[model samples]
Target: MLITLGRRYLRPYAPAIGVLLVLQLLQTLASLYLPSLNADIIDDGVVVGDIGFIWRTGGWMLAVSLGQVACAIGAVVLGARAATSFGRDLRHDLFDAVQTFSAREVGQFGAPSLITRTTNDVQQIQMVLLMGFTIMVMAPIMAVGGVIMALRQDVELSALLLVVVPVLAVVMGLLLWRMLPYFRAMQGRIDAINGVLREQITGLRVVRAFVREQREIERFGEANTALFETSLGAGKLMALAFPAVMLVMNASSVAVLWFGAQQIDRGAMQVGSLTAFLSYLMQILMAVMMSTMMVMMVPRAAVAANRVVAVLDTQSSVVEPTTPVPLASVNDGDGPRGVLRFDDVEFRYPGADEPVLAGVAFEAVPGTVTAVIGSTGAGKTTLLGLVPRLFDATGGTVSVDGVDVRSFAQADLASLMGLVPQKAFLFSGTIASNLRYGRPDATDDELWAALEIAQARDFVEELADGLEAPVTQGGTTFSGGQRQRLAIARAVVRRPRIYLFDDSFSALDYATDARLRAALAPRTADATVLVVAQRVATIRDADQILVLEHGRIVGRGTHAELLASNATYQEIVTSQMSLEEAA
Candidate 1:
């Protein structure tokens, strides 16, 4: 998985990677050459009393050392650039893929897990890539070159490498195998911790209201401890690796000295040669150690890479059309430009036995209001979601103007409708920034106009900074009623052909709701409007009202018509108000 991810995203930085490899090669060669030069200096310059040879050899050694430093620095710089670029591209791809997802896909991979994959998982792969480009590329070159050079110093001494190398490899390999499962568990635990933290933070108000702070703290601590345990398990295995490598390395040194002493005393080797041979052996073992470190990172990186790749590979359930029908082309002398229709539409969530909506059909024409009223769990919000393609209908079609929504480009569908979701979510920005989200070019005067219609301009104008006031994430800084009004104002500013308000007035008082709707009517007179509401009074004056029960439309007519004819509609109205108020 790690290799696959690297190959895909790193392919674009091939030239940088090539240069990095070359720099590593040059640096490793210089490092290997130095040990040989030291042997020459000791054997000929020192022993033979040749000062000129010493000076000349020292100069060459200094030059080689400088070149080695230059190459090493160059390799590190290029490696960083390549690795960071790979991370950037991978993160971008993950975010883009997520944006294409329907609600089903987003729910499949919970938000915390998706966040981990995009951030921490991508970071793991990036760190490994950086280490690979720096230390990994040089390890084999140093190992092979050291072996050849060690042989040049003393062939018999080189035999010790056979046992020492294999033993280190076996020990490190076993440790790596043991650590793999722990690394995988650690990633999952991180997701758990993130989930708990996010849930607690977002619902802090609820926690305080219920006085469950201590319980929530314990829950977070339990998740934190689980992550710690998994990390500690991996850390212990990693701790065992270095000591084992050092044991072999120290034992190899003893063997070299023990055997080399015999060769030197018997006139079979020079003192300088024995010394140089040991240096080469240490270089070989060091190279092996470097490679082992990289191997240790592989298992974890591979797990993380698999997670990132999973997100990139999973296609969204709501697929876009290959050849989208243009918005202008779809009008085709339709009933109205903003007309929306649902033809026998039905929707069922994945793995669910019963449908959320069945045999549902309705239409909202331009210059008219269509209101959907239902008891809780009657699929009011779900029905609204289908029109915007948040989830496609399982059977039948949803069309805007005369075109099926699936055939229309996603941007085109979005551009034609202004959706104020049931939950009024706002990004972290100034008031003007959030309001202008739908229409970036809207002027301050236009913004005030929309806010006035939404009954939000009074409070906004009274604020110290008015339009420039700061709004925190999710609009938590504002009261629920304020957030709802701001969201409505934002939608109104877009001036879209069609408007979707999914229980948008639930937070407002009866007076405010009535006033806002009265002001909104004339402003949206030429546009289509769809309102999903639980409150009977909220939709009582609509040109058309549809009462839903058990995912099916049980009644359809004006408030007076439904009151006269439909029992379900009458039941809901009486539950919310007295017969006098209903009249």
Candidate 2:
């Protein structure tokens, strides 16, 4: 998964990657050459008491050292630039994929896990890429070159590597094997922590209203502590790996010097060769250490890569047709004029045992108001969702303007409809910005007109800056009713072919609600209006009403027509208002 994601996002930066590789190669060669030169200075010049040889070799060493530094710096700068850009592009693709998902798909992966994958998971992979480019690319070159140079210096002393290198590899391998599971668990716990934090932040008001701060804190602490424990365990294993490498390295140096001294006393080995042997051994061990460090990062990055892949691999249930039959009429050959039809539509949420909207059929003609009324959990919101392909029906079809919604491109479908959800969400921006969301180029006059119909004009006009009043995130600065009103105005401004009000008027007072509906009646005469309302009075004057109970529509007709024929309608009206009072 890591390799696949890297290829997809990092391929565009080929030039930067090529430059990094070239610089790193030069840097590694210089690094290896310097230690060999140092051994030469110690053995051939100082030991032989040759001043010219010392000065000449010292100058070469200084030049090589400076070249190594420059190449290392250049490699790191270019590698970091490429790696960071790769992470950013990966994040952008993940965000775009998430946005394209339907509500069903979003719920399957969940927001917190997705957030973790996009941020922390991507960071882990990015760190690996940065380190791999800067270090891993050169470690093997140094190791192989060092071993060959050491052999050229003295074959007898080179044997130390065969023993020391194998021991370090085995020990580091054991440690890494034990740490992989812990690293995977740590990523999961990070998701848990993010989930808890996101929930608390989003529902802080509910938490405070119920005064459950202590309980929430304790819940967060448990997740935090679990993550801490796993991290500590992984850290402990990593901590052991470095010291183990050092122990083997130091032990090999001791063995080499001890044996080499005997050979020197017997006049079997030159001082220069003994010095070079130690440098080569150090280089071999350092390369192993670098590679082991890379091993440590692999577990965490692998886990993250899998998560990112899961999101990319998920196919949205609502997919467009390969060969679509385009309809210019919505139903029964009625052409595009905002006519909507639901033909035997049945929808069940993923993993749900039964359908939420079962075999329900309805038609909403242009220039008329259709109300959907039901108690909580009556599939009111789900029904509204289907009209816009927020979730496609499990069976049957929904047509808009004579075309199956699936037949239309996503953008085209969105442009034809305006939806105001039950919970009004406003981004952090000025009132003018939020109002302009539906119609980016809407004039002030058009905005004011929409606001007037939604009953938001008076309050917005009273603000010191009028439409320029700043709205906090989620419209936290506004009251519930105010947010709902602003959202309604936003939808109204679009003047779409079809308008869906998902209990949009629940926040308004009786008088305000009456006036908004009255005002909207004339304005929506050319469009189809679908209102999901909880209050009977809110829909009493609608051209048609569909009353749902437990995901099934039990009554459908005008107010008087249903009252005369439907028992459930009579029961609902009786519960909310006496028949005499209703009359």
Candidate 3:
């Protein structure tokens, strides 16, 4: 998985990586040449007391040193660019893939995990590339060159490398292997912490109202502690790894010097040769250390890569049409553009015991309001979701204008409807910016008109910035009623063929709800309107009303007809109002 992701995302940066490798090669070669020059300067120039030879040799050494530094700097710069570009492309692809996901897929991984995979996981991969660029490419070159140079000085001294290199590799491999599980655990813990924190922050109001701050705090602490434990476990292994490498490195250096002294004493090697051999040995060990540092990051990065690849690979359950029916010219199919129908529509979440919706059937046509009223968990939201293909019907077809929704391109299907979700959301922006989301090219006058119909213009007009007011993320600055109205205004601005309100008016007071509905009546007169509501009064005057129980339509009639005949309708109505009010 790791190699696959690296290959795929790094494809575009091949040229940059090639240049970086060249730089590292030049730098390592220059670094390897320096010790040989020093040995020559010592053995021939100093031993024979030749100042000119030393000067020329020293000048060459200085030039080589400068070239090495320049190459290293260039290599690091190129590597950074390639790694960051890889991250940018990967993140963009992940976001686009996620955007195509239906609600079912989003729920499958959960939002917190997806967020971590995109940000933290991608960062891990980037870090590995950064370190590998600086170290991994050069390490092998330096180590091999050092061995060859050391053997030129004395083959006997180079023998220490056989023992040292293998030892460091084994120690680092074991330590990293043991630490892999902890890194994996740490990522899971991070997701848990993120989930808990998000839940607490989003539901802070509910938590405080129920006086569960302490309990929430304890929950967060538990998640935090779990993360700490995993991080510490990985940290301990990392801590052990370095000292173990240093031990092998120090032992090898001691063994080289002790053995090289015997060679010098026996007249088999000069002092300059011993000095150069020692330099080469350190270079070889240091190369091993550098490679070890890069390897330390690999296991974590590999795990992260797996997670990211999984997201990219899993296709969305609501697949797009292979040959999409173009909605633009196909709007005249069998009925008016806004007509919607459900035929034995059913939805069951993966692994659930029973379906959320079963054998549900209904139709809404242009120029009329169709209201769905039901108890909590009666699949009101799920039923509305089917029209938008938020979740495709597991058992039947949902059609718009007599064409199956799956047959049309997702974007084309979405263009025919304006959906105001149960939980109204607004991006952080001005009133004008939020309203323009419905139709980006809408005129200011069109925006104000939509706001007026949605009963949101008065409050917006009173604000100091009016249409340019600074809205926070999720429209958190506004009251619930204000947010709902803004969301409705956004939908109104679209003037789409169908308007879907999934209990969007639940936040408004009776007067505001009534006024908003009244104003919207004419504007949406030629469009199909679907309202899913909990309050009995909210849908009482609908042209047609359906009362749902356990995903089935228990009653279908006008308010008076359902009130007089449907037992479930009567129970719901009398629960919310007096018998006289119910009339």
Candidate 4:
């Protein structure tokens, strides 16, 4: 999974990667060459007391030293550029893949997991790239070159490398083996911590309302502690691996010097040769240490890569048509206006035992208002969601103007319908910016016109900055009703063919709700209006009312007609409205 994901996104940067590798190879060769030159400076120049030889050797050494510095700096710059570009491209692809997913796929991978995959997982792979570019490419080159250089200094001492390198590899390999499972476990812990944090933050208001702050805090602590324990275990293995490599390296250096001294005493080797051999041995061991560090990182990066791949591999339940149904021309046959229909639709959430909405049917003609009213959990919001295809119905079809919604491309469907969700959301921006979301090209006059119809203009005008007044994230600056009004105005600016309000007026007072509805009536007369209201009075005068229970429509009539025969409707009216209002 790691290799596959890397190849796909890293394909574009092949030239940059090549440059990084070339720089690392040059740097490694220059580094290895300098140690041998130092040995020559000592043996033939100083030992023979020849000033001319010293000057000549010193000059060559200075040139090699400069080349090494240049190569190191060049490799670092190129590696950083390649690694950063790879991370950026991977992040872009992950975000795009997520955007294409339907609500069902999103539910399958919870928001916390998705967040982890995009951010934490991508970071893991990016760190690996940084190490791979800087160290991995150089380690092998240094190790092999160091071996040959050490042999040239003296072959007898070169035997120490065989024993030292293998022992270090075994110790580091064992540590890496033990860490793989724990790294996988650590990622799961991160997901748990992220999930708890996200839930607590998003529901802070509810937690305070219910007075569960202490309980939530305890829950977060448990998650945090579990993560700490797993991390400590991984850390212990890493701690052991590095020191073990150093021990073997130190032992090998001691062994080489101990044996090399005997040869020097017997007049079989030069002092310069013994010193150069030790330098080559140190280089070889340092290369092993560098490779070992990358080995430890591999397990963690592998786990994160698998998680990212899972998100990319899973297909969204809702997909676009290869050849979409053509959109209606500007002139509506239903007369150039937005007309919506739901024809015998049935929908069930994924993995659910039964359907949430069963065999429902409705139509809202252009210039008419169709109100859907029911008690809580009667599929009111579910029905509204189908029109916009937020979730496709399991059976039957939802359409606009004689064509199935699935037939139209997502953008075309969005252009024709404006929806104000049950829980209103506003971005962190000025009032004008939020309004522009509905119609990016809308002029200032059009924005004010929508605000007027949505009953939001008065409060907006009273603010010192008016349209420029800043709205905090999620409109935390405004009261519930104020946020709802802004959300409605955002929809109104679109001037779409269809308008869906899924209990959008519940936050407003009776008088305000009444006035807002009255104000909206004229502006939406040319567009289809669908309102899901909890209050009977809110939809009393609609062209049609559909009362639902248990995902089925139990009553369908005008207020007076239902008052005569629908017992359920009569009971709901009696509970919420006065006898006089009910009559």
lDDT of 1 by residue, 1-583 (tens): 8989888998989998998999999999999999889989989999999999999999999999999999999999999999999999999999999999988889999999999999999999999999999889999999999999999999888889888889988888898889888987888999999999999999999999999999999999999999999999999988898889889888999999999999989989987888888888888988888898898888889889989889999988787999999877766564568899999999998789999999999889989999999889999999999988988999999988868999988998899989999999999999999999989999999999999999999999999999999989998989999999999999999999999999999999999999999999998899999999989889999999999998999999999999999999999999999867898
What candidate 2 gets wrong by more than 4 Å, as runs, is: 321-336
Best candidate (score: lDDT)? 1
Candidate 2 residues 1-583, lDDT tens each?
9888888888899988998899989988887787778887888789889999999999988988998899889999999999999899889988988888999989988899999989999999999999999778999998898888888888877787889899988888899899989988988999999999999999999999999999999999999999999999999988888788888888889999998998889998888778778888888888988898898898799899999989888887777677654433334344547889999989997678989989789999888899998778999999999988988989988988657889887776888889999899998999989988978999999999999998999999999989999999999988899999999899988888899999998888999999999999888998999999988889999999999998888999999998889888888889889987656
TM-score of each: 0.98, 0.95, 0.97, 0.96
Candidate order by decreasing TM-score: 1, 3, 4, 2
Q: How close to the true structure is residue 234 of candidate 3, measured as C-alpha lDDT?
A: 89
Question: Per-residue lDDT for 1-583 in model 3, tens only?
Answer: 8789888888888998999999999999998899889999999999999999999999999999999999989998999999999899999999999999999999889999999999999999989988888888989999889999988999877778888889888888898789878987877898999999999999998999999999999999999999998898989988898789889888887888899889989999988888888889889988988887787788789889999999999899899999998776666555576888989988999898999999888899999999999899999999999888887999998998888989989888888889999999999978899999868999999999999999999999999999999999999899999999999999999989999999999999999999999999999999999999999889998999989899889899999999999999999998899768978
Lowest lDDT block of 10, candidate 4: 328-337
Per-residue lDDT of 249 in model 1: 87
> How accurate locally is residue 137 in candidate 3, as Cα lDDT from 0 to 100?
92
Q: What pairs collide in candidate 2?
A: 329-402, 330-402
Model 2 gets an lDDT of: 0.88
How many residue pairs clash in each candidate at the backbone level? 0, 2, 0, 3
> Judged by TM-score relative to the true structure, which candidate is superior, 1 or 2?
1
Could you give me the TM-score of model 1 versus the true structure?
0.98
